[model samples]
Target chain A: MAFKTSVQKYTGSINKLEFGSGENSKALGGENVLPFYTFDGNIGGKPLIGLEILDVYPEKWLDELQQIYGDAANNAVQWARFVEEKFSPDFICLRLEGADPNGLNKSPEEAAALAKEVAQAIKVPLVVAGTQNHDKDTKLFEKVAEVLEGCNVILLSAVEDNYKKIGAAGVLAYRHKVAAESSVDINLAKQLNILLNQLGVKNEDIVMNVGCAAVGYGFEYVASTMDRIRLAALGQNDKSLQMPIITPVSFDTWSVKESVASVEDAPEWGSQVERGIAMEVSTAASVIAAGANAVILRHPGSAETVRKLADALINN
Target chain B: MERFMIIGERIHCISPVIRKAFAERDAAPILQRAKEQIDAGAAYLDLNIGPAERDGEEVMMWAVQLLQNEFNNIPLCLDTANKKAIEAGIKVYNRDRGKPIINSADAGPRIDMLDLAAANDAMVIALCAKEGIPRDTEERLTYCTEMLERGMALGIDPNDILFDPLFLVVKGMQEKAPEVMETIRLISEMGLKTNAGLSNVSNGAPKHVRPIIDSVFAAMAIQCGLTAAIVNPCDQRLMETIKTCDMIKGNILYADSYLEL
Candidate 1:
């Protein structure tokens, strides 16, 4: 039973990142092993839960979610503050859904103003997201990144198609960071990391979004994929892909009708609030197992569930 | 025993004159393969002087020193059936990196090598195959457990004793692939790392199919929680497959934008 004990040395060359200044920034980084593996190393910190604050209410959101934050849905500043006071999230993720190509199509400058306004309102770290459109995301992120200088926020979703522009802006304009996203497939996950590094973004400046899926869907696939990423970084020491991962748990959970729909949809499904909490917790736990460094969530109740679980998983 | 490791295998030992080369201290061919293997990503050079086992100690000592001298204190795996040779090589081995590994030990009478390795403070590779290769996961795991107990009795740390599941060549027993992968998974689940002679999976296969089979097997083994392997890192396709596999598995983080599928 005496297993050989040795320090798990990462095989790849890694570039480190500094998040917040002084004690707060040092708070991030340094997970040498996969999440929740107490036998290996210290899993000191919980995955930071950043609440999503859209400049405008997502019109398509389920009614149940709308009821919770309906008052601040129309105002970005109020929404940011509401998320902070109501949920006490570790960070504020501001998604500029209004700048979609077919939506309001707000210019980057306008989006930047809203982003700055949100950042000033919240004491927590900020995550700036743009419309899913590749071209628009690149352009819109640039302005927001610039106006939010010294905020030490996290930029969102720099996909392969438009990474150069987005990466350049995040590094040069914002003192913030970026997240590299890929489809469920693992190869795409790696290729995207190489592309981001080539763009001159250091490893610490980038977070990986392995593309989260809700529980009982493609979530396991995401979990296994993320687990593989952490193993390669911790065990094999492959530096090109060594970065903390971001899992947008709320978006994945909220999108699933089982989370918010009534019992009438499926009497066996049980309470909507309970189901939402269960789904979010399961999704976050799965990703954490795969070594997610941060997770963005919705439902105030679900966020609290994940935070408590993270404490046990990471700290214990 | 100290748990320093030497990941060794026979795939890259490209010399029919390997024993003679080491015996004569003919640095040319030995140096060539050593440099190639290490540069191709070998962490330790496995010096297996089979067939010519009489001067095991002499040849092993010379080759180990020759490899370390030229390769900047590189560690070695003194691979052979000859016990005296293992002792000879270790006597001269510089203790900076690690004690020379006694290529392997196992259950059955082969288990004696476990005590030999322990007495010498050297690490050893423990194959789950004692008399012969186990045909199923249960048998393989049983052999692993027995060997682990035997090693622990000799005061050898399990980490120092790498469990080799004996990578079976798919061309001969394709059905056993899953069984072998399952064994790897079980070992990893125990939080113990395993190493396989990765090149063994492709043995007897067609030339072009070698790298493909090896890389795919390496990927699958990795998925099963394998920590390392004995393979040529210079194989571009295989290396690329490993690199890409690492990313997909999330073992390594995605670079700036490259990991985007």
Candidate 2:
């Protein structure tokens, strides 16, 4: 007998969520099967790759990245324009890392203004992320959402501690999308989505950052959590977890010892540049396979490779 | 909500190993399979000895005592064509974890299984069919209502009677898939628990695709309110799908090691 493939009939699908505005807007999710399981069902829109551009100058970056960005790294708008024109990423993610109270302590207004400038400079969609501090992120995101109102940008995260404030301002008031960030746990991820929904945030206006970790540094938790979330969304028709997942791979990967350790410090670990790119690419690929609808990457090389991987697996 | 129940279907007579184990009265193979299923998160083990005919009573009794004694009195379902075998098994069954399930009673000749279940105060799998497959959801529901009423008349608690929608293979009965789900929904609306031989839906399917079909069907059926299933808990993909579905449906609390559970 000729082999006839068994097709799955999924009752639920990942929400097809569109981020950004106008001609450059891109949609993620909408898949009715496990990631890249096109033989069973629709894979929907291909997973997206966004380049991470920090709001403040990246003083802590390695020389490999410094060589790539040069003086453009000093300004958020210039950095966004440079990566957009040079690497042509699907979107630009402006992370307000400098706004942390323990860091540069940049004011919310300054971060918001820089975000607006970057948003205007890039034709692709803009994703604005905040520092990890709940109070700082709440204020930063609120200011950024208000300033970038009607831009239809995505706020990088609305965490459990500050979902109410960010969800209200970004999703409710400004009509922007909110990525509900959770640690590497499916229950926490689902709970945040439920909380966001109860706060009157529509399902379409919500995305999920179920959390990310560098490869080999507890990356299994991230992968397994994503798998469980996707399975629940499609297999069980779970509405709370149906939102598309967007993992910030760059932040986790680049900060790891594998990527950051100096060649002199670890002479046997090969070139630092190659290690960093490999870390980013490996993490991105793993997350995509584990069912991330989109991933944010740092190096242009890693972003290019991941974009090719996504196109090859999903487009064909 | 109750956690989704996995009635492990590994200890059946069809497998040559198990059949041999039964014939020789060997505890090694049967105990190994039972322990594997239990460790894989099966809530109850279905002991399908098929038709023992001459030795049905002795075989069922021996198998039940052997497994229960070794596995700390694990809950079980007695499956066979011989009603006397089911009764023999129940004679030595333990109810520490849960009541033994009689697998099963139908609207036809096996209808008396309900009497056996009620007499023993045991649970019963009520098949929603008479002889063969039902014509449609309506027929299945008809059989279901008949069995439900019979169990009630026998003074059996409705909760102890798990309605079986009788999963039909998708290879030839593709159109009946939705009907099975509908039957589950209707049974759920009646406030009754439902389970099925989940692997039946993937029978005749290629080995590689059986897990996909079974898992997908399990998920869809679960969404329609299926409360339990007789399945091979050893299929990792299927078990993962079930765990994910249970968490999504709010039956089990989610944890990082939920799959391990």
Candidate 3:
């Protein structure tokens, strides 16, 4: 009667993916063990934080976030540099928010030029995300890929509907890593990796982004999705689900009402800053424990806190 | 592709050619065997330079250096009863390719090999045996748990400690073969990776039937969650069988030319 060792060995590992190029490049994922369990297997690279920027100033952001950046938040280049010098993010993610057809309706050329400028302005890697509009992402990513040819950036995403076009563009033109997005479904996530691979995107170049959310906003659904995806990749050794995970925590968590509500509005919840940072960090920590390799965050303070936890988990 | 590892067993001291080469310190035959296994897609190169009662350390060092130099620094599994020989082999092991593997530790007398593994930060193949091979699956599991707790207490990464259920020769113990598979299934359910010396199941059988039994057992063991194995990768049919099994099991990404992977 010994202490029954619950140690599990994985047959497969989360693939290691490198983004950007040269000295500033960042590699993510590549763990053979469950997240934060360095006692089990190599933790691969440290969990990375990609600070989110927008092509256009967000119209709906809380005043607190807007005040945090002031004039710097209005321009992509300054924001990228600001975050690079201030927070030292692993990568700067540019969401082509204005390119959304329902938003500013900025043309692909406008977004592409803005992307090149921001990519050039920062030392860290660039993650040029799209507006979630399938048609728009297809066009925008193609132009961005062409403009940033051989730059080795991480193309924001390709949903199942438009993965072929964007994934091909990413591989053929720029040699970029394309994040394959899934709708909180493990099969869809695995299927998307397969489809992307079929398009000649090397499995090493595909990142699994299965849609990140806040604590109350289907966190369990997304967290379970991540756990199942990891179990499939490592436990069942499913190659289709072996891509590294990229969870954009701030995209969903920061926009939640709990993160933005004023203290007067929700006095019991305490300061919005604390509530917001806690929401983003806790969401990231939970997902990281569930095997997320990358966390796309917005707030610099929260990014530092989450990354500290990640470093402790990795080095401990 | 997220494929499991295949450690080639052809370079062990028990093999006649390997033993002859070890006696003469000839690198030619050993290198040739190593090439055959590498060509057939063996991820790990197991080198057993005999029990280094006297010159085992030198033999291990020479073999490790020769194998690495010839194979562009391939990862090696140092298989020897002599702990010092394992240490000697590890002294020259290249870390760039992969981690060095300590051939074995058992829950019985060799449980202290866990200390060697921890000290060197090397992976180990832990056999589930107390006095001899276990009489039943429960007995095997008890030994496995004993080794696991011991390894973990020393802060050894659980993933690095692979389990061996002790594959029995199928010629005499036909009924026991299925139980090995069952033990593997039970171990897999516990979330541990399992390994077996593939040739052991068909040892002393007719040469033609050996590969057949080995391949069949390999596929069956894979189905039961055996993630690592020591086999003669030079067996094209057996290699292809395991490769196809991996593909069908969704362990490896399918491609038009997956056979090359």
Let me know the TM-score candidate 2 reaches against the reference structure: 0.61
TM-score of chain B of each: 0.88, 0.98, 0.96
Instruction: Quote model 2's iRMS.
Output: 5.6
Q: Which structure among the candidates has the greatest DockQ? A: 1
Taken over the whole model, the C-alpha lDDT of each candidate is 0.75, 0.91, 0.86
Q: Write the per-residue lDDT of candidate 2 for residues A158-268, one digit (tens) a residue.
A: 898999999999999999999999999788888888788878999888999999999999988888889988877876667788999999999889888988899999999
Fnat of model 1, as a fraction: 0.42
Q: Which pairs of residues collide in model 2?
A: none
Ranking by lDDT: 2, 3, 1
True contacts kept of each: 0.42, 0.16, 0.11
Maximum-TM-score candidate: 2
Whole-model lDDT, model 2: 0.91
Window of ten residues with lowest summed lDDT in model 3 chain A:
A56-65
In candidate 2, what are the lDDT values of residues B101-165, reduced to their tens digit?
Answer: 99988999899999999999999999998988899999999999999998999999999999998
Using Cα atoms, each model's DockQ against the true complex is: 0.19, 0.09, 0.09
Interface root mean square deviation per prediction: 8.2, 5.6, 5.7
